[model samples]
Target: MSVTTTLRPPATNATAFVPSLGIALASAAAFGSSGPFAKSLLEAGWSPGAAVTARIGIAALVLLPVALVMLRGRWHLLRRNAGLLIAYGVVAVAAVQLAFFSAVQTLSVGVALLLEYLGVVLVVLWLWLRHGQRPRRWTVAGIALAVAGLVLVLDVLGGMRVDGVGVLWALGAAVGLAAYFVLSARDDTGLPPLVMATGGLVVGALALGVAGLVGVVPMTVTAADVDLAGLTLPWWVPVATLSLVAAAFAYASGVSATRPLGSKVAGFVGLTEVLFSLLFAWLLLGELPLPVQLLGGVLVVAGVVAVRYDELTAPREPDPAPSLTPEAPAPPR
Candidate 1:
């Protein structure tokens, strides 16, 4: 629709902080809930590939009308941003899910998750190396604490068994996760967040479906009922939640959060998804987390707070003064 959008510049201020944090947490909660629902589907004889593909496909269809409305009949918007759409879909959406699912086949969920969260470190490294956006000392400290907390939360030390192949796949997913934050935080892209989310899901769904047909991953599904939230419900309940709450709302809000929170801070906020997942599993499935895990959650929150504090307190580079327009005879002398 050629709707001009203005971007928030520089860093987050005190006034804008709450709204950004709220949206980020909302995204994390929505995304975290997907774990239990997806788990239930798997227990009900749905392959990981099938569950992911269906979730993405249905979410895309659900968001299509809204995305089109945002597009406002500006066909050129798609043409101009095709590369971004494809990359977001392929790397951030498809690759992340595919690789993580594949990794879990060999590795324990906790270990695989720890490895994938290495994407946080990778994000820091990428910014440092690629854009020279070196992390402040506090940012680095927060990252270390967050990762250490993750190890505790995931009980990675308790499961020292490793598979070489799964490590590689998880690392690949880490890259994909990094791509997600990097792509989402970009302000120069003309595409709206909802449009980008929808397009990425569509592309990811097609890619995974093709992989399934070629036998790269299993595509089996069953009509059996599943146990979730201690209730035996038809398989569709989890499926619907995964598509609507997890994929649609989660991705849209997650994408929008990056515009204000920036990539690094948003990644820090994303670490909370693990905490939310545990909370959901406990509430919905009656599985309580250990005391140590509760401690880990606190550390994770501390890490996020540390990063937010740094962003607000850090000194800003002063903006350059504007040049006077052709004031001195357009002097090129």
Candidate 2:
């Protein structure tokens, strides 16, 4: 069997650009809802570790068949990029969930998210350092404004004391997430996104399973007391959905989209996840941010815009070949 991979060429046409934006927005929406939904599970008495483990474990299972079908003709790529793929799943997907859950247990969902958005600025820095081009002055200014806005959003100065270990975990999530984008953009040796997606979740699930077995995290589940809108449910159901849909679909789509949207562009656009989460919370839980947090939210958007203004304004790169020539080869020397 043969396999084909789609590499993300920069989008130049109006049609392509619009679809990328829509995909990115949809991904953000799915990811944003994860927090509140996960919170419900935790409130139902699932420990953070167990909840996170279940979410990824189930997601891995859901994705396995898809990966198998996609990689059926080309299993060799898995061996080729095994290390990078596994790292992406473990660090980016698994670590982010565990950290965010811990953060939300102590901090409000909005506040925890506001801190995680720091990854945007971190991505800007990563691009600058890795590529030797300074982010535009506007981008710098936006990052500053956004960070300041996050302080306001998080109310870091208003006697907000973060849990030390939790804070560390959240920071780790940021680092892992940034690496995820950078690495996902690298070639996966022509593996399909489904294959890459499956491979990552498998590695993450295995690692989490081992941790559970070693007593680092408890794997046992028992029914807990909780009621939701007149529905009786096991505590694991919500967390499991979070893992399979929110985290799995979200991560796979987000990672796969990197091929169509460059890493830097994807990072900037992903800021929408915060807004989506806020909207979900408002609608689902009737939870509204305080007036101060609202202002902070605006700053976050402004900051992201400022940071990304250059790419938004810069001319798109030209396509190398005509679409009609599907088998276009490298120009002869």
The 0-to-1 C-alpha lDDT of every candidate, in the order given, reads 0.87, 0.69
TM-score of each: 0.93, 0.82
Tell me the deviation in Å of residue 265 in model 1. Answer: 0.4
Give the per-residue lDDT of model 2 (tens digit) for 142-172: 7777777777665666646567676776676
Residue-level lDDT tens digits of model 1 in 289-325? 9998988888888888888787777778889989877
RMSD in angstroms, candidate 2? 5.9
Model 1, 72: alpha-carbon shift in Å? 2.2
What are the root-mean-square deviations of the candidates from the true structure over C-alphas? 4.1, 5.9
The reply for model 1, stretches above 4 Å from the true place, is 1-10, 321-333
The numbered model that scores best in lDDT is 1
